[model samples]
Target: MSLPTTTKEYFWKELGSLANLSFRESKLPPLKSHEVLVKIHAVSLQYRDLVIGLGQYPANVRDQLVACSDMAGEVILAGKDAGSEWKPGDRVSANFCADHIAGETTLEIQQTAHGGPIHGVLTQYKSFRPHSLVRIPEHLSYEEASTLPCAALTAYNALMGPVPVKSGDTVLILGTGGVSIHGLQFALASGAKVIVTSSSDEKLKIATKLGAQHVINYNKTPEWQEKILEITGGRGVDHILDVVGALDQTLKAIRIGGWIHTIGFLNGTAADVSLGNLMKVCYIRGVNIGSVAQFKDMNRLLASHPEVTRPVVDKVFAFEETLQAYNYLQSQAHVGKVVIKVV
Candidate 1:
């Protein structure tokens, strides 16, 4: 089947802030060599998108950015060198960190497809390099697969890389948000005892159901780190997945020679990160979303771990309800990934 050369493409445009976001149709761009055209099937809403739309992403892109990063779609056109690996009808997901296909951090490749650096995937159809995507797992629906490219991949990288997790390690995750939830699953699958902390006792209950070995209501137990020590018989946790960079709660919670991976500062970024905290760290690393290659490896790992699924997909909205999805995610009342079905 031949690809549609052009079509009336629908996309959400950013005129200014989140207040100015509107859905509109415009001419679609033609597919270029090494570029594959995908018909977007689902777009998941993320807080970072809200921050980008509101002009708060740490390195905000040029204004009027498309304003979303995670999306799953089907390939309709493959570039000349793209090979037959992905042709029309393949279900695949795009990696938000498009250029970091191999190796560790390099400023050059990191700039290319990061949501802040270029046009993102908020549109109905998007063009990406054939090398920049991974096939959705066979058992997952588009929306479920859509959850991985950004949030899940980062969680996988932060938990698994630079040092592979081993059995019996204590993994502490803050918040019951998407990344933390996903990190919780991966940690459990790795045979580690997972501890989740949240202000909501209700959410902590849900976390326990999802394989969290322990839960801390950060509200009542403001000294949750003490709870971690108590839970582990005062050994302290070996690794912490810090999605909320709330001050140095994560730093204080970790044991001496422990690692903390920062994926977000939802808790607050301004808090002090003392040298004393670092004095004992095995590694306090910052994870950007992972590369296309790492994404594929993660998929392989995910396929084996049935426990690793999208934790709390609270609602699904129609394609035209993209705005509603964004608003719902911003509300933060939802437990899991809030997704929009885009045909």
Candidate 2:
């Protein structure tokens, strides 16, 4: 028996630019037996949000769809059969792929991603299946927890998945963006040395403070791969988190028998790599975020080691200023996650 009836939400009215987003108020749907109504407190922005806003994502680009995947909220109401685990006042966050509870990912599960193809949590309130929501760490505020689902989970999966990173191995992170920053934190937690690259000396200095053992200025050293080889004594890095999709540089920078996780395309979408380069690495795995089970695993790790895994939020915006947040993201001035606080 909840008293709140109407909710305010942002919708992507057309497939074009950020200007197409529309705001409106709607009546909250009747909660299903297995549903929990969440009062969204904060949402985080991702690069994909920009692509989705620009109508560039390959799938699930629908008119009037909600436009964000990461959010943290409190459970305001729960249906009779919602489950014993949930109650009013419980803080939670939604998984990136709502249907991926456990096991390997499938096309069906991938298609159910929030934001682009599905209605997202960019609203004041949203109804979610209990299985799709997980409890947030008690030590983290709603804003901090909102940065996890996509960026943090992707980094965690890259480090802890099939090819697990280990102590003493060196990891090369491409930039100072959300995913890379999270990767740097996880790599440090795994007891691995980190090498982060950026065009800015300032961001590199920040990365150094965040525990990166070495920072390279890619703009200053256009042939940054050569510098990586020089730094590693020609052995190259043990793992390369290829956020830039810079295949040529990645090929040159990864040591033989190392792993490379392809996570983003900030530099370019297409590239040619030598067959010789392919033979040297363990594998080049393409990382989408992760499953709900993986999300839980990440949360467990975060709870145990809060110091090593705090999300770096660059700026906070009011809920009405989502467009400004998007513009800020487009400017690429932020070093970490951009967040929106929804009161």
Candidate 3:
């Protein structure tokens, strides 16, 4: 049994944007049988959090829903069956799926994403389960580790799953956003050729510095997918990280039997139909943010990958400047992850 040291706890609450989030004091819930009291060190921003705050992301879990996904923290109080890997002082990262503890990511387990259907992490002290908290890799600071639970892990599942990519495989990464950035590292470290595209040549240049062998400024060539086919000598890419979303341009972008991870809708949500092009080019698979089991699996592979020296942080904002970070993300000016520092 644990006792509270303070009568009130600080949490962020926003019923809507007109009333911007404010700090509220609340009492802690009783700890569950397999939960730990975690003192959160950092909270990560996500598109879904902004959507939820704007009343765009709907959830049955009404009001008082905290608004952040990824977090890093230390265990404070451990439950009886919380197990051996976690202790009072262990530094850890929480998975987006608070319920998917480990092993295979079955469909049921994969459905529990944070900051929407479940309570979010924008608080100082949160009750975490052993299933949700994974120990941090030794090389990363809490801030760096905090960004991986969703984006990096999703890219991992897209590239490093049961399928093995070899020295000469080709991957086409669309855009310079978080998913594409992580995808670039995975492709480079796995000995695959990477072709990265961006609307800005300047951003493409930066991605090239990050090990992209070929860069296409889509702004320069509107028929950029044709440029892709030309660069690959009409063979087309073996894999395409189509974070481009519902765009039919990506449908024309891959070789037959090649795989495409349909992760986000950054380009456009509703694009023209091209069933023939999609069938002729390749296969498409939708990706969610991924699971804790997947996170551990990917971490083991990534710990050894030379290309992933660190998550490329375009900028870091102070904890209080989280809204600014969100606005910057809205601007789409960065080539990689924009982080917030919380302590």
Question: CA lDDT of 315 in candidate 2?
Answer: 96
Model 2, 1-343: lDDT tens per residue?
Answer: 5357889988888877889878889898877888999999999999998988887776666567987999999999888998888999999999998998997889888878899667888999999999999888999989999999999999998888787888998999999999999999989988999999999999999999989999999989999999999989999888888888887778878899888899966667555577877767557888989988999999888888898889999999998898999999999999989999997
Per lDDT, the best of the predicted structures is 2
Off by over 4 Å in 1: 5-16, 269-281
Taking every candidate in turn, the Cα RMSD to the unseen true structure, in Å, is 2.1, 1.3, 2.8
Query: Which ranges in model 2 have alpha carbons more than 4 Å from their true place?
Result: none
lDDT of each residue in 109-157, candidate 3, tens digit only: 6456666666667666788778888887777777777778877887887
Clashing pairs in 2: none
Clashes of 3: 0
Q: Write the per-residue lDDT of candidate 1 for residues 1-343, one digit (tens) a residue.
A: 7556543323325544666676666567777787889998887777787787766667647545665788888988888877778888899998877777777858777677545677777677888887778898887788888788878888988988887777889999888878888888888888898999988988888889998988988889987877887888866788888887754666667778778888875656674567866666557788988887788888888788754554457689997777777788887777668888876
Which scores higher on lDDT, 1 or 2?
A: 2
Which window of ten consecutive residues has the lowest lDDT sum in model 3? 3-12
* Alpha-carbon lDDT, every model: 0.78, 0.89, 0.74
